[model samples]
Target: MSDDLEILLTNDDGIRSTGIRALYDALSEHANVTVVAPASDRSACGRSISHAVDVHEHDLGYAVEGTPADCVVAGLAELGPFPDLVVAGCNEGANLGEYVLGRSGTISAAVEAAFFDVPAIATSLYVPADDETPYYEFDVTTDDFAEAARVTTFLAEHALDAGVFDHAAYLNVNVPLPDGDPAPIEITRPSKRYEMDAERNGDAVHLTDRVWESMDPESLPDPEGTDRRAVVEGRISVSPLTAPHATNHHEILEELAAAYRSQ
Candidate 1:
């Protein structure tokens, strides 16, 4: 970690997303920030990268015709100087539960950066639960993201010095929308509640996934230590995660190996 640090900023929600813009403004105040992000919304794209991407310069930064992973790869490998940290999102929607982590483009960007040995942070804001709300309905203006941006910038400024990434490649942060008062910050693990349903329509089937719809504000089953619980309780959730998959040391694999040796 040098005295002069360079940060690569990217997002799943394109360069012009209000979340990214708010983050860029906040980070620019503390570090040398470079924004290289998807030109269009790439939410839930996971770690998929484009084979060939077309990039163009926007007033805000470099806009790439690709996924969030492509932006990080191009930014670190070709577009700019190697960064001390990679910050993704302030995503419009919350990416909480364990099932959603692997599907979130914001988290995938951080995971991709971790493979390159750069510490990263993926952030999102959880929209409050309301039945009247339309699907993907959240007013994430630049002002609404100030608190999240502040926290992210503060972490970026000191995370390296504090050795936060020594044991983890990236951190996933989810901030609840500000409601006049500052929310408490909590370190949490991803929750394991999944809500997916499919319905039949004539010959074709229509699939509907409504995880948020099932979230009961009065009584969520998740314990206090989970990301879903924290967010539901109006707290900022931070989950430190590693990039590599965990290994299983089951007897089945050992037996298979032994059988192969006997053959």
Candidate 2:
């Protein structure tokens, strides 16, 4: 809990989102937090980058008219102080399943930081959705982010010194609305369940994620030790993951190379 720690805070939900503000306030108490986030809500924008973006000076920090990845690049390269860690989100929605990893702006921001060799933590809240009222439509307040802020602040204070980064590039964290006791933290992995439905109309194809229908305790298809299940049961899910994808050499490719040389 060193007050001297430098943290670069960014999020996919824009600078004014309650989630980011809650996180900024929480992290500010423990470290030097510089909020370099998008100027508008850029949810699910993934790792999209901009060639050039406008920047504005805000009371919290700098706001960029670009994607979350751009905010991170700008913060690290030009704007804020060089940081010890990058914390993205307290995101409006959960970035839970493996399918969402490449398509979540919150997670992408953390992945970008990981590529820079800086450890990061991307936090999101698992807001359950029903047939009538979705989580997005709920009047989510700053208080809703309190637990996420607490979890993130604790990680920021201790993770680096504890050598957690040696085992992981970044951590993708998902928390649910608080229940009786504080939610238990579980080391988990992104669930592999992917359910997409595409219905063709006259000239349009409406796509839906069928997985949302199963978010309830009775319907969740994911098992224990998975992100979705942890959150569904009111537990905090933390997936310690690597940044770059892995690759391996194979004899088939080597043989092809040898044959090409003969030609």
User: Whose TM-score is greatest here?
Assistant: 2
**After superposing candidate 1, which stretches have Cα over 4 Å from the reference?**
1-3, 260-263
lDDT of 2 by residue, 182-259 (tens): 888999999999998999999999999988888879877898899999999899999999989778899999999999
Residue 189 of candidate 2: its Cα lDDT?
A: 94
TM of each candidate vs. truth: 0.94, 0.96
Clashes of 2: 0
Q: Output the TM-score of candidate 2.
A: 0.96
Q: Per-residue lDDT for 136 in model 2?
A: 90
Model 1, 234-263: lDDT tens digits are 889999999877897999999999999999
C-alpha lDDT score of every prediction, in listed order: 0.88, 0.93
The true-structure Cα RMSD of candidate 2 reads 1.4
